[model samples]
Target: MSNYDITLPLTREVAAQLRAGDSVRLTGTLYSARDAAHKRLNELLDAGLPLPIPIENATIYYAGPTPAPEGYAVGAIGPTTSGRMDAYAPRLIALGLCGMIGKGERDALVVRAIRKHGAVYFGAIGGAGALLAEHVEDADIVAFPELGAEALRRLTVRDFPAVVVIDSTGMSLYESGRAEYLKSLK
Candidate 1:
């Protein structure tokens, strides 16, 4: 696996060079959203309405962070299961979404969409919410405030770490790792 120091707004050229299992420290802007927001996004798409937030060539984190404590920009913000967004990912990818951050393996459809769209999927370390929150320098609700913690948030992050779970080539660290483990058991 390679290590990359990426400053976001991840472009297609940069995203295509990433490989599954590569580690990255991403610094810059990203939007935070979860299942509730994704569902709403799809609904807007179906009705031919423009998205509330600009998704083109953008990265999104699947999370619902808790309220900030004291001086923190954000609280314990951890990734939710990536599979939960599977139902909505293809549509977003088709709209030029480039990167996604969350935990767990994605469904087949989402994987295929990422490859076709030249996108990347990063796997944030799970169960490290508080530690992850330290990387977020700022967070502001961009849309859907009624969803509470699940509202779409624009975040400024520094040294935010993640692993490339699915690269633009459609390579998957989850599948490869599982295969290697099985081979080792033989």
Candidate 2:
């Protein structure tokens, strides 16, 4: 797999060049949100209200971190299941949301949206929250602080490791890798 060091506030040109199964070390500011925050964001969207954070050319990490330990910027900030955000992802992608960081596979509609918008989906390893937190240089609540861990936070990450789970072209490593494994056994 190819390894890429990408600096974010991601652009469509950058997103389009990435491919599924490629390893990436993403460094830059990204927003964080979970189910509760996503629900609220959708509510704002439905009302035609302004979103709390900028959606254009931005990557959102699907996570809700635990309380930070003494002297640490954040606690175990791990990826939430991506499927939980499926209902809202397509609309956001169409609005210029460029990338997503999460665990698990996305539905077909979300994949189609990513392809159409030239967006991407990155996978953060599950159960490695503590390790991942080490890459978080800084974080602060950008909105919805009342939701506590589920608050939408602005996170500045440095060399955060991830895999291209689904690329802008709609290619999915989950499907391709599984297919390759099955073919090998035949």
Candidate 3:
């Protein structure tokens, strides 16, 4: 229920301080990667190959942004369904990925990994891509450019809005909020 203004490359301390249902305006650096990029990263991990981006204390956004128009930092950078990345998320979290930004429910395995690793999962507004793009100060494709929109990109965001849907302790706002609403109806 509290609000936070946090910067990225989230440390264990920062991750632990967050709680489910908290509002956040995240600033600083984060990476964009959809399911394809996540799969590639997992393959690299499995093969003992170097990853395209640093894994430690990193925050990955589940977004495949559109091509920016003239003078824009990004275009329609809305969150993709986080479940698409669920298969690969635990491995990344084990490698020190401390935060994620997307929409919808996460799988049980992903939630467990977040709790075990002192990480947090944030939810972005799904249909507010144009509004979200305004907060992105910079964006550059960093790897897998061949994948176009699915390519890994580095984004610098300022006051990017999100809500903490799952906190480090494994509290899930989605579950709790839904239960509360259902209870209210009864």
The root-mean-square deviation over C-alpha atoms between each candidate and the true structure, in angstroms, is 1.2, 0.9, 1.0
Using all chains and alpha carbons, the TM-scores for the candidates as numbered come to 0.96, 0.97, 0.97
**Could you tell me which 10 consecutive residues in candidate 1 have the lowest summed lDDT?**
48-57
Candidate 2, poorest ten consecutive residues by summed lDDT: 69-78
Taking the tens digit of each residue's C-alpha lDDT, what string does model 3 give over 111-136? 99998999999999998999999999
Q: What is the C-alpha lDDT of each candidate?
A: 0.94, 0.94, 0.94
Error of 3 at 44 (Å): 1.1
Winner on TM-score (1 vs 3): 3
Cα deviation at 105, candidate 1, in Å, is 1.5
Residue-pair clash count for candidate 2: 0
The positional error of residue 23 in candidate 3, measured at the CA in angstroms, is 0.2
